[model samples]
Every structure is written in structure tokens, then in C-alpha cells.
Target chain A: MPTLRLLAILQTDCPTCRLITPYLNKLAANATPIAAVSQDSEKDTSEFVRQMEVRFPIQRDPGFALSKRLEVVTVPTLYVLDENDRIVRQEPGFDKTALNEIATLLGLAPVATPYDGAPASKPGCTSRHLEVQTEDAAAAALDLHSPRGAKASSIQLADSDDPYEYCYRAFGDALPVVPPTAERVEKMLRAAARDPQEVIARIPPCYGEATVEKIAANAVMAGCVPEMMRVLIPLARAVADERFNAHGVQATTHFAAPLIIVNGPVRRELHFNSRQNLFSNTARSNSTLGRALQLILLNLGGARPDAIDMSALGNPGKFSYCIAENEEENPWEPLHVEHGLARDQSAVSLFASEAPHGVSEHNARTARGVLKSISYALATVWSYRACMGYEATVVLGPEHVHSIHHDGFSKQNVREFLFENTGVPLRCYSGDDPGEGFAQRGLYKEITIDGEPCYQKFRAPEAIKIVVAGGTAGKFSAVLGSWASGPRGSQMVTYPI
Target chain B: MPTTLVNPMNERAPQAAPAAPRLATLQGKTVALLDISKPGGSVFLDRVELLLKQRYGVTSVIREMKPTFAKPAPAGVIEKIRGADAVIEALAD
Candidate 1:
């Protein structure tokens, strides 16, 4: 049975395929036998057929088997085959002259003209089968294990649809995210070396189960390299710790977010930025690691800004706030070590805090002088009149640390000095004012400083935390005010990585 | 063939729970006013307590304050409020 026919390989999203639809219909109307192969899902293929008013018989190529077998590289590839299945003529894209020539060969009048309001020629989209090949290559390079047993739900995307746009619309943080394709997620899961179905933590508000697979997907979206999974695993546990009060942190109408501080050998190994512009987007490790946690909170935990996250004046740190302790330049033990972890051990400390307030003391040359200037700023934590209930972190710059360390001030000495020296003058509180101040609450102890009566700021020296960071060139330090302190509020949690 | 991606969101289907039965009336009933411990939450609840007593004849108004406003009500607080015929919670910022 020898019969000549035309074969067209197409995908719904290719513009060239849509452009050539009318010409293909014209040929079909001319009594030409044609078979069209659609490299798309059944749903998408049906829509294309109905919308384009396709007159020819079309068949679905599941998994792009037919396109792969035919070695098709570009979509809208038209082939004129003889009765023996030998190619007589082929066109890869839309070309009016080529279509007219093919029409002439079929003993028909010209089917295309310049007045068609279409381009004379247009390039075609790559065949869908090629994407699988590229993904397979990447998987092999990463030595990824089987993803068949993955537990998370899967979404199918047509080859023509923009994956980035689809991801943004579906699960974005009002910013662009990397598409969490199966291959990329699998790579992260394999690196984690943990069961994909293992539940790390249940995020609050929605209490979504953050399985390893889901976290990997979010990490992929946050643009994290696979190596960061080790840090992220324990970090997730810290967020879910009962003492952290994640439910309150997520739902509160206050400026509080989990600030991650990385310490130990992993900081150097992962190249986390602990130097100049400590909190800026200078390092990929610092930026992506922080972003991954936020994505996890937003996607897996469902703490969407418009929904559960009701911070009145949302802090910028909600976007990404992570830093490594500059242990090399630090005069005191790193924050994690001070909290009882070994110096060599890797750990992540989570604190619920507001944004950093920079303090400039370019004129101070002694530890006493530096503490006095920082104390003035520290006096305003939580509120100018409120005291004894808040906590703060003093991110001392290298230059400031140098001055303090040169004066032989130990870390404890620094904490004690800040606690005693920081206060609000009693004269600042008016008698007509309500009971917002500690003076009215009967919680204040008056002390004289420079012959002026003032109320002490923090209840204890331990309420102030200190960490060394930033460039040695600047005398700038920063103070991060805590959301709330003690058992009732969020307590800083640290977990070893 | 279509491209497949892993779902990055929490995939658990949300379970539907029945809402609590509504109170028939406030008169001659005990009401619980829960102040979430925010700065102005107590003031809001104070007015609510006054209105409930003056307008609805609510008796035995019990006032409860959470340790902090940032978290859910503690189990003890929830149990205490469970005894009330009606409860009003203030969510002032």
C-alpha cells in the first residue's frame, strides 16, 4: 500500500506552528493527506486543535516518543514523505516561499502571499524532547538518585509556557524564583542525604508539614546550592522549636522575624560573608541561604505577607537576613560558642529581632567612650520610656571592636558596661503621661549618671548580646532590637549543624 | 510531552472543622474577655466588657490576659475560657 502524505511535528506554544495553521488547513482542503503530531499534553493539544480549527488528523506523542524517534530538533517541522516513508521535502519553520513551492509540487495554487499579515519567515521553537535530554545530562552530572519515589505533588507544564512566570504566579515571594524542576529538586534531596519524606518541622499558621522534598523544592526556588542543605536542615528545626513561638512570630502585628547567625568552620567552608557589608548581598551563600528559609516560611509554612504575616511596619530583614560571625577578627568567643557550642562545631542561632539600627562612633577612641555613644542609642530600644523587658544585639564593627579590645575590655565587661550605662533620664518622663514608662509601672531603679537621675534600661546584663562583624575601615556598629524577651516571648534558639 | 516540576508548597489538604455552636443569649450569662496582651488590647477589651455588662446584662465577666500577644492562647487559658457561655478576644495592635 503506497501512499504519499505530509507529516507535521508541532507544539501548541510555538508561534510558528500557529502561523502556519491556515496554510496547513488550505493544503488539507486541497485533498492532501496529512498527519499532525502534537508534542504537548492532551489538554493543551485539544485546545490548540479547537482554537486553530485544525482540519487534519492529529495524534498525541506521549513523552515525545515520535519526535525523538524522528530526531526532530525544532517545532513546526513539515515533511513531505513519499509512499515508502522517504523524505521528499522538509521545512523547519514558517517560510512563505517554501510553502508556495510545496503547494506547487502538490499541483495546487500558491497558498501563501505577502498580504497575509504574517512574517515572511520565522524561527521555530525547540522540540520538547530536547529538554528531557538536557535534564538527564544534568542529573547524570550530579549523580542524582531516583526521583520516582518523591512524595510531593507534581505539576505539569507545557513546553511553550514560561516556567518562570508559572512559578512566580503560583509560589513566588513577589520576586522571581528559579523553577523547582524535578531534576533540580532531586539534586538537592540527594545532597541532603535524608529521606525525602522525612518531616523536618510543621510550619505554623497553616502548620504545613515541611518534608525534605518540600524543603528541597523551596531551596531550589531560593537559588541555593545543594551544599546548604546541611545548614538548612537544623535551621528548620530551630524555627519550629516551641520556645521560638513561631506561631506568634508569624501572626503578630509586630516587626519580628527569624534572624539567622551562622558560626564555626562551615562559615569559611561555605564562604558566608562575615566581613565588609556584613548584611548586604555580597555573597551567594549568604544571600541564597537566607532567601531559602524565607521561601520555606512563605511557601511551606504559609506565612504569606498579605495573609498571616501582619507586621505593621515590616522590617527589610524579612526578605533575607543572615550573617556569619567574623571569628578571625572577633576579640571574644563567637556567639554560638558563647551560647555553649564548641568553637570548631558548626551551628545556626535564630533570634526574633527588628531591623538593625546603625551607630556611628568615629570619634570614640576608648572602650568607655565607644560604650557611652552606643549606650545613647541602646537607651531607645523597644521605646524611649519603656525598659527592662527588651533585648538587643550589638553588632560591633571591627574598628569599634579594636578600640574596645585595646582597652582590655572582656565580652562580659562590655555587656555589663552597656547595661549600667544605658538608660533614659527621669526628667524625660512627664507626670501627665500615662503608665507606659517603667517609672509609672514601679519597675524602675533610679541611678545617677553625670549628676542626672536616670532609669536603668535592661533588667540584666545578659539581655544584651554582642557579635563582631563588618569591615575594619569603618567605626560603625549596629544595634538590633529584640521583639520580646524571656519565657513568654521568643527565646533565641541555637542548633548544631 | 509536558515538563513536570516539584510542588514547593505545603501539600497537605486542609481539614474542614465544624464551627463552635453560637450562644443563644448574653443576658444572665458569664462572659470571658481575653486581652491578648498587646499594648491597646486591654483598653479595647475593657470597653467591650463595659458594653456587655451594661447593654446585655452579662454577669460574672472574667478578664484574662495572655503572657504575650504574639502567641496563641495557652492551653490553660483556653480551658478557663471554655467554661464561659460567650468569649470575646481582642486583637488590637
Candidate 2:
């Protein structure tokens, strides 16, 4: 085999170099060659070549010193340097120029075009504009020349005529999913810089490995596009945080799971529905972003029904529960910004929680009255078995925000008001009804001291985290309290993607 | 493959249980009632406790109801069940 030394120097928009790369690849395949990239290469030249599926011996130089040493100013520079380091001839660039012209000079027959009905002279490579034309032509030629074959008939677990419905039934999924195919999964893979095989975290109990590829597959199954993976990856990492206690969440009868909150420019960029119908399935990002998390839970973590996760009457949010912080409407700072993150930076925060209970305050004329209603709802502890203590989150809608802010109420003020007034007296929960599992667990009794029940007392002001979200439509906000978080009480974890 | 079907000339069908008096084996057995809440759970447990004593020879039934439903069940509940011969979770609303 003969070794040909080739060097290509590029500009931001080089034509001849683009046209010759594929030809060089073909030439390299027929003969041994060394392709050294010059430092003066275009910003995306290497990437462009990679996308074109050109595979050949190549090197890149950050500086064009090599090109200068070769004294090759004109590009698409073709030099047929033999193994002995002797230049047979130096062609400034190819332009309908030939192997025959060089072959005649080197005493060899003109090289054939490797294609049928080919001419001795190909085409002028001098015209930089001819690259795209010939490149498309060559691509079409390759497509025609390549062998045609039928797809293999193989039944895969994730494959079905009705992939979404089938996978949902197979996994006993709470919500339907978009079946993940190899092509779609591969698309999701493009969102991350991480290697497909790199293990991000291990799912609890089942100890299933969650690799970048696996998460991407689940994201695809969850109907996530490549762009959605940016949000999904961070949400997965947040829940996988050891402090999140995914193991206990799945194993315990508590119907609590991860609640995703996004903060950053990505919210607007991804068009997260933080406006009207924010939490509803009204927008693509809203549904798919949340669905991506669910898919990861089902396929990667194996949190299937009647299986590892024993959630009785599992809430619909289990399918996907995520919302972007209404940074624009928040009276103070956004949730992420309040947590010491930059206002403009993007991040994902996970909180262990149950389904949200709406606190409607449509008639409240003043902030105090509205706070009283919210406080009443916040104190209603129906789940007395929760001994790990209690933490509440207030997701304020825009209408509610205006009413409260107009009355000079801050989010902290709302939290304090809820902390001070929300709980009911112990007697309200004490009863003969058999379904009161929380009181039967002695949670109220634990809060009692000195012969007086302290159930009405606020455990801590910090127990309540107030976040503003939802659409601007109604004066209704939701009060979502944590399930019995057990030993590992709910913790908010934030991760940057 | 052809589907197969059988037709019986007699056409006898399965019969339901007869209306006879049947004795319940759960009678006279001591049961433990535990829950995750206090007042509401104890109310349910009280009814369960009364039922156990009246219908069965459960003269001495120990009952424990948790204080809060929001927290996970404590270790004591499991330990109490371990000592009892049988346990019934008194789930009350």
C-alpha cells in the first residue's frame, strides 16, 4: 500500500476543503494516508466532517504552522508525497485536474474513477462553490451504490404496534407513554455530553443502573425530544441524590415522590408552561418534561405498580409532576434564585411531595383573610402517621399573588401566617373512624406534651416552603405537604445541567 | 390450529354454596390493632377491639394507634404485632 501525506487548512467558510474531505476519505480507503489538520481550520470544520460520516486518518493542529512549513497557501492543496518523503508533484488545488496528468508526469496510467462509466478527468475542484454540488452528487452516488436490505424482524420489550399503550400496560404505568425507539432514543442521547455507558446513578432496591443511554431511552419513551433531555437529566440526578431517599420513597407506603421545579433561561427557552394551565397537560414542554421524569422512574428505576413501589391510589403526578418557577411573576426572587442560585442561571430542584391540594381564596378581600384560609388548609393534617414531621409548599398562582401582594403580603409572611394558624386542634383528628391511619400511628400524641396536645402549634417556620407558580388565571393556590418522609425527611436538592 | 368445543348432553352447571350455618375460625383469637394516626385511628381500633371481644373470645386485646398519619409507622408497631398471634390493620378514614 502507498502512503499519501495530505494537509488541509480551513477558514470559517471554506468550500474546496469541504468538497475534498469525502474524496480524501475514499482515496484513503483505497490507499494508506496521513491527513493532518492545520491550526487554521474553521471553527466547525472537524464537526462538519464528523457529521458527514467521513472516516479516515486525520489530525488537527490548533495553529497553521504545519501548513506554513509545507508552504501551501492555496487550499484544497493536493500533494502526492511518496513514502520516501519525495513529492511526486505539488498541485495547488484540484480543478477538473487528473490522476492522468499527474500519472503521465509520474510514468503511470491514469487512475480510474472507481465508478462505472467514469472519465479520465473528473471535474474542476478549483471552484470552492462546486463542493456542495459535487458532495451532494457523491452522496447520492453512494446511496445508489450501497447495498439495500430489509429491516430485521425482531420483537423487543419496548417495541409494539401500539408502543405507548403496550409499554404502559406492561409496566403497569399510571400514565401512557410514547414508546421509545432506537432512533428516538439516539436523538435524546445527542442532548448530553456524557457518554452513553456512563452510569449517572443506581436506582434503589432493584439497584438498576441508570446510564446516560438508559435515561435517554426512558426520556424517549416518555415522549421527550432531544431538547427535553437537558431538563430530564438534571431532574434524574436530583432525585438520585442519596439524601432524596429514593429507596424509602419507593419502598414505603407513602405516596410521595419527586417534584421538579425548573429555574433559569431554559424555562423560557423551552417554553415551559408557567402561565395559564401551567401544571396541566396543555403544553409540550410541560407534559414531556414531566413525562421524561416518569419514564426514567418506570424504565430505569423499576418503580412499577404492584411491584417495588407500593403506592396505593398513586396520584396522577406520578406519571409526571414538574413546573417552571414563574420567575417573572414572583414577588420576591424565584425559588432557585432564593436558594443562592443566579436569577438567570438554569437549574432543577427536587422536593419529595404528594399531590397538591388547591386552596381557593376567591372571595378573600384582604391578604390577611386569604392567609387565614391558606393557614387553615395548611394545618389540616389528615395523615397522622407522618412522624418524620411535616413540611408544606405553597404554589401561588398569579391572581393569588396579586391579591396577596396588593395587601402588602410577602411570601415569607404567607409562610409565617400558615405556620402560625393552619393546624387544627388534636380533637378534630381524634375519632372512631377506622380510616384515620395517621392518628392511629400516634403522630398527634408525639406532638403532645405536659398533658396538652400541641398539634396546633407550628413545628417550624422553615417547614413551609413557598413557591410561586401556575397560570395567571385564578386566585387559587395549592398547598402540597410532604408525605411521612420517614427518617430521611424531604430535602430540596438542586443540580445544574 | 382449530378451536375445540365440547358439548355435554347433561349440561350440568357448577352450583353455589348452600345456605348453611358456617363457623368462623377467627373467633376467640387475640388480635392487635395498629394505625398511623391517633384519634381517628383509635376510634377505628376501638370498634375493632370491641368486635374482637364480642364476636370472638378476644378477652385481652392490646391496641395501639400512631399519633400522625404523615409519618411512617414506627418500630414499636411492628414489635407489638410480632408478639400478638394475629394482627389486623384497622384502616379508618
Candidate 3:
């Protein structure tokens, strides 16, 4: 015997739909199980249920995502699917004869005096789905409901039950997350302004396909608003870049996290703090945007703490470490402009780095003086005497950026100064065991400058990326060392938002 | 009142390939010793290699080390180890 399912697609705003709603109500109340799919907001759908005395479950289409897929051409399109979910019969418009046939098919007595004191037949209003003619666009529009263009299932829970517990059982990372309700995901999808089924990239470890809808689910869990989707979508793509080494980063024993820095006009639009408490939990966009990416990696990529993510000592940044460049406060070009993106274009740069260590230069007034203190802080990147030729980010506070600029040093000048000054001497590279000594001495790495094989600090001048952020009151800067700087580990990736 | 919630997990089961046939004996066989690069791994594998050569009469021994202890080995490393009659890989802490 085939399982029975009846779906009635209707719009409360349509008059012909209102005329045929009584028969739909009768079928719902007495005949069989029916779900009324309404192409309207929940408020309007609930009002329609009350006014029309509808007893069936009113499923909110919210964005018309389901209506477009069912190809509802009119206001009153009805469908009945069998055990295999294949449509057995479809009825359109208000017809008394069609109502009688539906009642008989549902194993009810044939309708006697159907639509009493009503017209025999009436044409329904055109479906809003047909308003968009292109099939590809229409299909893309439905991605919020069907992520990756696959069939979706929504489970029902008791209203008295806690929603946070529902997400924490399996899809959580030791934190209570906002439930990724269908309505919430739909709103997030619309904010992204892209196809929900669009494949951003395949996340590593588990290598799960990260569709826009799936990514939005994670974003919703992170307590992100709809507008934050604009930032999170591009961010979801940045981790998938091979240069970022997200695969190795996930499976590594090294303490590495995806460090993100937002630049250009979007910082202000999203209210990212480029000033005081920039790296702290000062802005909703900054914190949740970073948290959303981590949630995506955990839920979609399956990079759990005890599983593939084998960080020996995971950093607090594993929760979230995102900050925007203080573009207006900085004297030099913003971080994105250094990466060749136009200053007007909003972009995000992803770096695989450790937690930040503060570098204080309170007494240093000149550029070289500040650089001297910063080089020691930079020298502690991979190891104090290791001299690892890896990348490091120098987050210059607003005061330090101005102090360096006032001394006539550009961002490149500062990077070059750090590179030339930071090194461990040949005499200091010795220990008990030769093999241990070589590994500890930052061995097998040397840069020749002025006819001297000086064991240099970084691979190149640009290895020291200078990002100017934080407030102006402090004479402090921060250094975040890289995990592994080349193909050996993750490199920095800049994605235009 | 009852409310409906959505399931946020991948419902599809993982697709795993079938295992290879078992080997009967180790005599005159070329065995591979793979180290995951973890601490104390080489010491354990050294004793195992010695036992295979002296007691089991293994012909040749192949050795390989994973790039890092964190991730799985590269495809080339796996193919190299697969050339042996039998392989012993460590899971050291």
C-alpha cells in the first residue's frame, strides 16, 4: 500500500484561493493528512488559518523557495504523492468536479452538493512563481529549501522543549548554538544575495560539500544576522583556498587558527571595530563572523577537537579572532591595498597564525627604535633562536603606525627593517646533541646580504605583513607568527568580498 | 504546543571500499615499515623489523615516514608501501 501525502499550495492574498479554501479545510479536517504550503509570511499564514478555520498545518514558504520548485502556476495547485514521493495527481483552480474527485481518491464519500451556492468553476490567480520566467534563476531561488539541490527534511520538536539542546546533541562544539531553523536559514540565504545551492568549496578532513545553504546553517548557529552573510560567504571560500592550507591546518598538531582581517568599506557597514578593543569582543559582526567560520569547519568539515583537529594547544582564537583594519586612522594604505585589491573594494585576508603576543615599545620614539623592540618580539615567532623562515603578521596599533609614518618609514620600510635587524648569531646556535642543536638553531636557513650569509629571520621582506589596527591610547603592537609558511603549512589568502 | 525543527547533519552514510584478501605466510615476503613520525615510533618499529627478518625469514624491508603525524600519508607514500607483501604502520602517541 502506498503512503499518502497531500500538499495544498495557496496564497492568502489570492481571492480564488480564498473561495476554494473551504474544500481544502474540509479535506484537512475530516478526510486525510494535509499540509498547507503558504507563499506568505508566518504572520499572514497564521491569520489566514484563523480566518478560514484551517485545521491543517500551515507551512510557511517564507521566500517562495518551495513554490517555485513545485511549479505552482496558479493560486490553488494541489498535489498528492505516493509512498515514493512521486506526484500521483495534481489539481489546479477552483472546480467543483475536481473537489469531488479529490474526496473520492482520499477514500471519502463522493462530494454531494459540492461548493453549494458557489460557481461551478473559477480561474485562480497566476502564481507568483511564474513572475520569474528563467528556469535557472527560479531553481537557484529555491536553494534555501533544498541545499545543493537535494531533498531536505525538517524534524518537528515539542514547543516546550529547548531549541538549543537540539543543536548541541551532535552539531555543537561544546557551546550552545542558535538553532538553524528553516526560516532563519532562508533569511540568511537572501542576505547573501547568491544562489543557496552554490558550492563555495569542499571543506577538508571530512571533505563535506559546503553549499551556501549549508554554510548559512552554520552561520545561523553562530548567532549571525542576515547581513553578516555578506561577510561569512566570502570567508567560507577563503578557508578552502589551498594557499591557506586549511587541510593541513585542520589535521596538524600545531596550534594554528584561521586569522581573518577585514578591510575597505564593509568594515563600517558591518560595524567592525578598527579602533579600541578591535581584537576583543567589541563588535557583533567581528565576533560572530569569526565564530561562524569555526562553526562551519566543525559542523560541515567535521574538524572536531578530539578528531581531525589535532592542535596540541589550541589557541583562544579557535573560538574567533577577526579584526578590521583602522583604515581612516592609519596613515598608510590599508591591508587589502597591500594585497593588490582596489582600496574601494571590500575584501578579507585569511592567515594561518598562532595567538597574538603583545610587543610593547613605550620608550622608543623613532622608527628604528620601535623596530628594534618589535624584532625581538618577531624573533620569538616559531622559536627564539630557531630563526624559522616563516611568515608573521605585525599588527601595529594606531599610535605606532602614525609614529612610524611620522618618521618617514613606509610599510615596506618597516618590514625590511625588521628583516635586516632580526637574526640569531652563529655562536648562539649550539647545544648538547648535534641533531637537536641543528633543529633548535633555526638550521638549514640562511640569507646572503652585503656578501654575508646571515641567518635571517624571515623568508622574504614581505614575509612580515604589517596590518594597522587597535586604538591610539597604547604604545603597543602585536605579533602573530605563522604555523608553516610555505607548501609545508598554510599561506595567507586574500578574498574580495 | 509542538514545533518543527530542522536536522543539520549529513544523513548519507560514508562509502567505504571493501578490504583486500588476507596473506597466508610471511616467509620470503617483502614487508614495509611505516612510521607516523610520532615519538617512540622508530624504537617500536625497529624491534618489529628485527623479529620479521630473524624469526619470520622476511626477504626485504621497506621503510617510509609520513610527512607529519597530524594528517594521513600522501598517495605516493601509500603506493610505495602497497608494493610490499605486507605492511606494518604505527599509531604512536
TM-scores for chain A, candidates in order?
A: 0.69, 0.62, 0.68
lDDT of 2 by residue, B1-93 (tens): 221111101111223445433435656556677775634566777787887788777856767665444335654566566556577675535
**Candidate 3 CAPRI-style tier:** acceptable
**Candidate 3 runs further than 4 Å off:** A1-152, A433-437, A440-454, B17-25, B35-51, B65-72, B89-93
Interface RMSD for each predicted structure: 1.4, 18.3, 2.5
For candidate 1, the share of real interface contacts preserved is: 0.92
How well does candidate 2 score on lDDT at residue A483? 58
Off by over 4 Å in 1: A1-150, A438-440
Ranking by TM-score: 1, 3, 2
lDDT of 3 by residue, A34-111 (tens): 888888667767767766667688787856888878878887888887777789899888888887887777776655
TM-score per candidate, chains pooled: 0.73, 0.55, 0.69
lDDT by residue (B1-93, candidate 3, tens digit) is: 555555555543455655656778889999999998765688999999999999999999999998765455865688678678788998764
lDDT of 1 at A191: 95
Stretches of candidate 2 above 4 Å error?
A1-176, A384-388, A426-454, B1-93
Best by TM-score: 1
Kindly list the per-residue Cα lDDT of model 2 for residues A1-497, writing each as its tens digit: 46445444433234445444454555555544536453333545565555334566455544455565676556656666777877766665443345335444444444433221121222222223222232222221111111111121223542224655655555555666555566666677777766765555555534355666777766666666688767766676577665566665665566686778888899888888777767688878877877777666665566666776777767777767887888788887778776777788898877778888888888987878877778767765435323226677788887888888898877777777766665544555555753443433454333433354545434577677878887777788888877544344546667765
How does candidate 3 fare on TM-score?
Answer: 0.69
